[model samples]
Target: MSRTLLAPRSWPLAVKVPLVVAALMAALGVLASWLVLANLADIQERNLRRLADVTLGTLAASLAAPVERRDIWETFDALDRLTATDSGMPAVAMVVLLPGGEVLAASDPRRFPTLRRLDEPLLRAALRAGDMLFDTSRARAVATYRLEEGGEQLGTLLAELDIGALLAERRRATVALVVSNSFLTLVMAGVGYALVRRMLGPLSRLAVAAERLERGEDPGELLEPPQGSREFRKLFGRFRAMARAVQERETILKRLAEEDRLAQLGRLASAMAHEVNNPLAGLLTVVDTLRRRGEDDGVRRHAVELLERGLLGIRNVVGAMLVAYKEDREAPGLTRRAIDDLRYLVQHEVARKRLELVWTNRLPPVLPVDGGAVRQALLNLLLNACGASPVGGKVVFEAVAEDGVCRFLIADQGPGLPADMAAILERSGPPTTPPGRGLGLWTAATLWQRIGGTIRVERVPGKGTRIRLAVPVRVRAEVV
Candidate 1:
């Protein structure tokens, strides 16, 4: 359920490509800035060290003669001049000390007085640490140089150089690097986004067109040739061809469906004619018999009974056809009569195959279900069973109402249903029609599904196929 950035396809190419470019640029910028800052800091430190060395060496040379003669005023003057003349060195304080660890002269006399031992712990530690020590915490460098004449140790000169300016310069450089790199990264990221979006514009258009096509709407101007590279043009051409093919196929399928419907209607009409003609012929024969024996009460009574049965048979056939084909705002509920009507609808098929139909109806007088849909579905199933049964074979049709549901079962004495047809019945979705075959079963399955009915099929190896349809009694009527 959770997603990660590593799955780039989840993001659009326009965004993903630009984001990757921006991330890579930012990383490179950070690395470059770090390297440049490091190098800049090194250079600044080297220059500061060089300046400190020169200032210290020159100051030591100037103090050598004065310290040997113990001229405190001249030594203090030399230190003062060193600070006044050199702007780069920024010497904070200077001290002249004797070889015996006694301070001879101090640039700040009140703090480090003449002829007093040096007591600055920081300066003492820096002196003991090395000839030149940088105390970055104090933003200063301390240097100690021995003032010698002819290789004789005359005295020592100590100087503290202020390095705050160098540190500030480095800070400014860092800010500049950061600002420049950020600006460049943003510029490149924006350019990348725009370019990628422009390049993939056709793909976005194609996607929109595809969605429109899927909804069975005309894409029209959406699928028009786009202005871009050759590959996009080719893709658009292929899509147009594909769309044309799809439209053509759909048109053909619609035509085929219309034809199939007409063919089915023709067959039903033929069967109705055959069924009605037989009953009508029998009624005419009975009428002729009654006319010839008008005085015989027995013959008249028998003829009247035959006429009533024949009329009833014709009514059942017509009534079943009307129930199957008629549409109403509110559907009638299922009943025993509707179930029995199916027998009349399929009698023509049963007779054509010379198959014996075993009909059973135990449903209540009325049940809360769409009677039309149920009747039509059962008729289709019974007709299918009759067709599948061989000549002189039995086609069993059973309907029962139990436990708030209506169940209908149809079994054929022929070979078991083909695997594909059985699979269609067993499937929960709308069933697809096999080419020129199994249309009846498909129609039945579709109707059953619309009314929230379930189907179960059992086929025995030595026997035949049994299909059971169960419909909830209280299911809402659905448009079939």
Candidate 2:
């Protein structure tokens, strides 16, 4: 399986933004529902209380004359009339009581039997004290009013209001609220998703464009000038400009690198001329000796051996120098043989400059390194060192492998390291110093970095500068 497939997918803004908005809407919806239901309940309770009080007042007035004459039939008829007129109210039953608290009559005789006196504290409070009483568990409300004739108090009328209708209406309202609120929440969720998705549309394109730029490909449509908000358009414009700048810089660097390679080749050509000339002279002399001594087998054999050795030496030098020029060469493991070959190529420079070249090779037989890159790196350093040294000045080149690291040190007896050279070793890329001053150093640094190596420069005021290139030893087999 691909690594990306195995990895968990990250939540995009498209999903996250909508989810956040939906959560907020849902929370607000719940809050609104609670408030609406609470208010509705309060209104229902108030209306129930009001209806009970009005019914009690009407019943008290109707029963006043009937109760004063103590007429049983008339009292029953008055109770019936009270309930009939209160059809719209939630009055379940009505009872007429005398001052002694005995029920004279009831609208529903079966429900509230006669001779049944409701002398409870709540009933008494409603009749003789408080305005009304309510029982929430039973969903009932009670109220009583005094029945009086002239200055004499006859009896009282008590009405029990059934709040079932209010409860039913509350249930219906809640259902309606739930249905309406849910639909609104869904609508809000859909609208929020579309708005958020549209708002973030440019972000995905920007990401793709950035990736394309990183891969050295044209950003194309992904980074096209955006429409809508000024900020978004400006942001995309900046991205396009940045990508163009990076591409331009990359092209310039590639050209500079190619030029540096050609310069190295030019230096190698000079070294090759000096190196090959001496071998050619020796080979020519051997051929002359072979022809003159053709009659003597022993002399001819010796001449032939000398000729072979001289030709081999010349070939070795030429081959060593050509290693750096090989096109698209793969780097091989570091070896003592490779280092010796590099030293051979630079021997001409040492001779031509007449500098005392102190050569030291203490590296292992084999180490993981790109042979071509390492050789080129060494060539740059040796050339730089040679150029810095005056005639008869000493130059030291040493290599040692210790503690699983290869250390190559080059020191030149010159004025000192230049300020630009110091900056080259201190940081990466083209040095801030003037052109032609730090290219070799920069190239050397670049080479070393490719092989996971570091370069350090140490300089004293009067003494010469010493550069140490340290590379961790990786075995060939361990390399990927």
How far residue 59's Cα lies from its native spot in candidate 2, in Å, is: 3.6
Error of model 2, residue 442, in angstroms: 6.5
Q: Rate the local accuracy (lDDT) of all candidates.
A: 0.81, 0.77
Best by lDDT: 1
Per-residue error for 203 in candidate 2, Å, reads: 4.5
Highest TM-score, which number?
1
TM-score of each: 0.61, 0.58
- State the lDDT of candidate 2 residue by residue for 282-334, as single tens digits: 88888888778878999888888888888888888887866667764555676
